[model samples]
Target: MGIDLEKGGRIKKRNRTAPKSENPYLLLLVKLYRFLARRTNSSFNKTVLKRLYMSRNNQPPLGLGRLVKLSRKNADKIIVVVGKVLNDERLYHVPKMTVCCLKISDSARARIQKAGGEVLTFDQLALRSPKGSNCMLLRGPKHAREVYKHFAGVAVEGHVKPYVRNKERKLERARGRRPSRGFKRKPKKV
Candidate 1:
């Protein structure tokens, strides 16, 4: 009799090895990184290639202020971001450092240049460091979207925001919120 094979085995799904971007320039970068990843045996090149395959939404935008804060200790190393770099108006002072990204806002480009810092494209960065040497890879906060506010279960603690149709006097502002509505549970003691 043949051994049973259908119950315990399953095929593994493979992720995309190449980028989905239609731009020729991006495709060229992917091709270069693919070669580097295969030939150089550097984990950095592999990581960069994987990020290059991500969609625009998956690659969130990094803010200038946050980048400055995170890379404060390592000023000499180049900061590489696979997505856009946006300018934060709240940041008063811009630091002097080399930053490389796919796209940067006009204001951000001006600020970095004015602060004696150089902003480089991915192609330029590739020429400078093929194996990602002397570079720091950084990404934006992926869970910072507003949609995450309503992800928790209903009436759960931890300040999970509730989804209300509209903000009004008699909408979702009664019952558990106030003792006068009916009965209010005692606050949990720490």
Candidate 2:
């Protein structure tokens, strides 16, 4: 299902054909709404709540201050999954970064050392940094590593390979839940 920018931006599509996973941005908006709901504790005006839910289709419900606060307070390991190849965006230019894994090979470590950055584990990142802060998360396989090589002072870590494997297992289990022919009961005549 497609999301329209208008119509108060609330979830407009509701059909069986809709995508299985929820939209990331929409999820963020829902989170924001939940936060507000908790803050107001049912005292918030109905109109305002409606507006909040409606506006979620196009943009985040909270401002930058809230975003920063939430990021700084909750995040420990930032794993950036680059949807596409990296570009000249300022995201990769930050001087310091906190990563979630330390699976870099010897050659990659050498590259990072030359760039004056160090790798850290997920635990380290969580103890040191917040969740959604400026800390950039670079994700992708070989392509992500290539992007890292282009930067002079970027730290890289975290192995999503295991995570993917785990996800596949879950999917397999879900698919294996169908009923066997022996479990079916014969229909009775009316």
Candidate 3:
């Protein structure tokens, strides 16, 4: 009826300006980042603010191993992740690190502290690096979930793991699974 009526009616734009989380702490972090993102001309603050607005699935948790590997080259800089930091049992050793994340697992926190590392929250990170200086931002594997594995396979590769309801030796492992059952389809390299 107003301005958009002449140009295809009201343009329906459904997007997240702020996080949907009702948590006070999350809200506080959002507020701080919003201010920082607006006041500061740094691209890092803008990136952080955009990531902060992502959903739970969008902001996947980073593993300790991945973090260690990624921050290896830039050891002196503070690692900033817009999601939770998780513990990886596969990684035997952990080095001293300065990490800033929204959430952290107890074991992960313990391991980091045990290694003489320091953990900082979003607010603390803002205080430390208001302009997001000397920081390396990282994210976890988004499609690491089991459900994604079923759908996220190359059909041309012939090595796709299809989703099946009943996984049993009598049925699932019968036809195109093993050579003994019949003949396993070998993946043809392209």
The candidate with the higher lDDT, 1 or 2, is 1
Angstrom error at residue 17, model 1: 3.2
Cα RMSD of all models vs. native, in order, equals 4.5, 20.1, 4.2
Instruction: List model 3 lDDT by residue over 64-163, tens digit each.
Output: 9999999999998999999999999999999999999999999999999999999999899888889988999999988776666556352334445677
Report lDDT per candidate.
0.86, 0.37, 0.89
In candidate 3 the C-alpha lDDT for residue 137 amounts to: 92
Compared to the true structure, candidate 3 yields what TM-score? 0.79
Cα lDDT tens digits for candidate 1, 1-190: 6544554334355567677779998999898888889989789889988999998877999999999999999999999999999999999999899999989999999999999999998889888998899999999987677776677643236456777898564666667656787756677753
Question: On a 0 to 1 TM-score scale, where does candidate 1 land against the true structure?
Answer: 0.81
Tens digits of per-residue lDDT for model 2, 91-172: 2222222333324345433443444555565335433542334455433333334344445454334212222345453453
Order the candidate numbers by TM-score, best to worst: 1, 3, 2
Task: Give candidate 1 regions above 4 Å deviation.
Answer: 1-14, 153-157, 185-190
TM-score of each predicted structure versus truth: 0.81, 0.25, 0.79
Residue 135 of model 3: what lDDT? 95
Please give the lDDT score for candidate 3: 0.89
Better of 1 and 2 by TM-score: 1
What C-alpha lDDT, on a 0 to 100 scale, does residue 113 get in candidate 1? 94
| Model 1 / residue 172 / CA error / Å | 1.3
Cα displacement (angstroms), candidate 1, residue 180, comes to: 2.4
